[model samples]
Target: MTQQTTLHAAFAGHVAAALDALKAAGTLPAGLSRAAVAVEPPRDPAHGDLATNAAMVLAKPAGLNPRALAEALVTELAKIPSVTAAEIAGPGFINLRLNAAAWLDELRTIAALGNDYGRSTVGAGTTVNVEYVSANPTGPMHMGHCRGAVVGDALASLLEAAGHKVIREYYVNDAGAQVDVLARSVHVRYREALGENVGDIPEGLYPGEYLIPVGQDLAREFGDKYAAAPDSEWLALFRNRAVAAMLVMIKADLALLGIHHDLFSSEAELQAAGKPDEAEAWLRAHDLVYDGHLEAPKGKTPEDWEPVELPLFRSTKFGDDQDRPIKKSDGSWTYFGADLAYHFQKAQSADALVDIWGADHAGTVKRIKAAVAAMTGAEGKPTPFEVKLVQMVQLMKGGQPFKMSKRAGNFVTLADVVEMVGKDVVRFTMLTRKPDAQMDFDFDKVVEASKDNPVFYVQYAHARIRSTLRKAAGEGMAPSADHLELLGEEELGLIKLAAQFPRLIEAAAAAREPHRVAFYLYDLAAALHGYWNLGNDRPEKRFIVAQDINLTGARLYLATQIGQLIRNGLALLGVEAVEEM
Candidate 1:
């Protein structure tokens, strides 16, 4: 077991023993429920290290005042070996002070686990599918998709660290009208490359210099064969070729951001292969499909509405406001239909599913959940699916809003952001806020080496540890793991921060929020920085000394453990912890 597991186990054992003692003493009624009791860190450090709500939760049922029950429980808890002091405070909280030896022992466990210090088995081998960055293959990824990519990838890594069998997926919209536009766009560039003036891109067409390369490749391969052919003859081939080339470029761009997916499901391939029909069959088998016309959207003018008879999913049966159509008026499946098929595939394959989408799709969440519930007959029960909507990210430079427009053809791509601030800075900055909260990415501030820049602050903490280790090596006083027990208060504080790693991982994975890990790393880095500053005021507190090799070795061990934790935490977020900033 990891150090965090050991610590939590010990703490839980002590709490359980206290409850048992309360039972034996007859101060508490027999057969009183004990499952709701919880032990967690105190909100105020001065209260004690940890606090429990056993007395507060039991007071009304036990017919006793909360403080009286807390006082009685505190007396019972004082007998446990792991608890140094137990005090009652604040309505009914039982505060716990752990023995100093327990904190010291955690340092040894950190040395043993090293970089794997915070790994856990909470997921217990369940299969989970995380889908994100499903940007259409028609164009390169832009700044908007970067946040979802980083958040999803980091969440996947966090789940893996917590022992989930995770599969990262990308859904490609290769069967849409956008792909047709891309083919037409590439054809214009193809004609231009062949010395033909395809003047002024027509309406409803893409105009970007990036497509010029695709045109050149097509010209070199086909050699004027499709150059003069009719659109009906070559449109499919051209669209397929252009989409293939664009997807390669998109994959390279995602690679620059350190994102790799285990699977890429194509909409075109699924449609051509009758996957939607199979999904409809499954829905029919479950009595979820029907032939009906949707109610025209409310509060809209008649000209803005189009009503048609179509095959519909009985989504309203599962709490949706209205049933949704699976096929469009043209008898082709809508994007929503494809999405239903994709989720059906996921439900059949994985034990759980999570999707990260842009905030524009927030309205789609209810219908999708309703469809899932209707398909699985799990109404009013939790489904193994969740969708997280990522809010917009506004890019700024020097306190001014950066402008990007498709008409100008100068939109900032993900590659541009990666090239400007580097992948580590981009990933960490994108995750500094919750996924649902809006984030501002200031080009000037991220690259700055100040405490205001969280990425630099955390990286600086790791670099400072390396500096200490270098100084120790120069003085021939590098500490060994065996001497870590000689650490003092500051060193023990650093060790305590390291010991919180596994617990943080468990919490983050359970919450499905990678931003929490980013916040925790910043806090841990602050602890290290404060400890390092202490050495400047007290010479005896320095991590290295030429006169005492044993003391220096102990301090070095402590510093090394802190460095390992910073690196591990940053790694989980797909950020880099540099030895030198």
Candidate 2:
């Protein structure tokens, strides 16, 4: 069993013992259930390692004074093997101090588990689909998409570490008007590459210079043979080629951020290849799709507003604010229709579905969730769908706002940020903030070699441990796991922090907030760094003493465990745990 389970079991045993003692002493009502009893870490560490609310919860239910019940429970808990002491204080809290040997055992478990120390089977092999960074394949990824990519990738890794069979997916928006604009953009570039003065790109078309090579490829492939043909005949070919090229560029951009999707579901493929038809049939079978007209959006007026009957989905019946249309007035499928079909396909395959989208799509959440519920006929019940909306990231340099314009072709690409600060730093910094909160990415501060830079601080702690190991090896001292018991107070404190890793993973995965991992790593790194700095003042506190080889060996073992944990945590964030600065 994991250390957390063992700790929980020990706490449960204590609670059980306390309940029995209360019954035996006749200080509490008989047959009172101890189900609400809980043992967790105290907000203040000085109180104790673990605090129980047994008395506080049972006071009124059992018709006993909280302090009197706490006192009796403390006496009962003192007999437990894992709990060294139990004290009753402040009305009803039963603070239990664990035996040092329990922590030592935890250290041994961590050492045995090594990199897998924090892994959990909470997901129990269930299938989960994590769709993220479904950026339109019309250009390279911009800075806005970078944060979502990192957050999604980290969340997938976090869930996988919790033992879920996760499939990372990316949706390709290839059948939309965006791709048509891309085709035109590439055609402009093609003419320019073929010695023709394309002049200025037309309004409402992509004008980025990145498409120059794509145009060159198009020119080389067709050689003006289809230039005279109508757009209908050549548009499809050009759109496909441009999308393929754009997707390649997009993949490269994701690679720069250390992200790669397992599946790339295409919108055009779904429509042209019978998937949408299948989805529509499924929805019709469920009585979710029908022919109707939607009310124009309220509280806002559009210049080209017109009312017309259209094919609609009864999203309101499933919990949306109102029914949503699946087809436009002109008989073309709306974006929402394709989205519903995509989600339908996902729901059919996976046990759970999670979509990571930008905050701009905040209004889209209710409609999508409603669509999922309507299709499944699971209204008023929880569905296996979660939408993680990531707010925008504002990039800054030296405390000033930094803006990039793609129109000017001077936008900060994902590649630019990754190339400047590295994939590890970029990933780590992006996740330091919660997904729903806006994040500020400062180019200068992120790479600074100081404590203010959390990425460097955590990495420095890991590197310091490595440095200690190197010093021990140079001095011919053994650094094996067997000598871990000789660890000092500072070393043991670090072990306690390491023991919390599995619990952290489980909590972060259950909460669906990967920022918890970042926070936990920061705390663990701080503990290690604090202990490392203690060596600066006291010679004996040094991990490698000149004359104490046995002590050095034990300290090295502790340091190795810390290094392993840092490496594992960094791996979860898709960050590199470097051995050197």
The 10-residue segment with the lowest total lDDT in model 1: 1-10
Candidate 1 residues 1-581, lDDT tens each? 34544465466667777777877888778888876776767778778777889999988888989999898888878877768889888899898887667776777677777777788787999988999999988778888789999999999999999989999999999998999999999999888888788898878887877888889888888888888899998899989999998889889999999999999999999899898898888887777888887887779777998778898988887778788888998989988898888787777777778999999999899888777666544454544788989998999988789764442154678887888789999999998899999889999889999999998999999999998888778866775866656777777667666666777787788778989999988999999899888879987787885677788888888888888888999999998888776
lDDT of 2 by residue, 97-214 (tens): 8877787777666677777778878799988899999999988888889988988899999999999988999999999999998887777888788788888888888878889998
Question: Root-mean-square deviation of each candidate, in angstroms?
Answer: 3.4, 4.2
The candidate that achieves the highest TM-score relative to the unseen native structure: 1
Error of 2 at 280 (Å): 4.3
Error of 1 at 254 (Å): 0.8
Model 2: clashing residue pairs? none
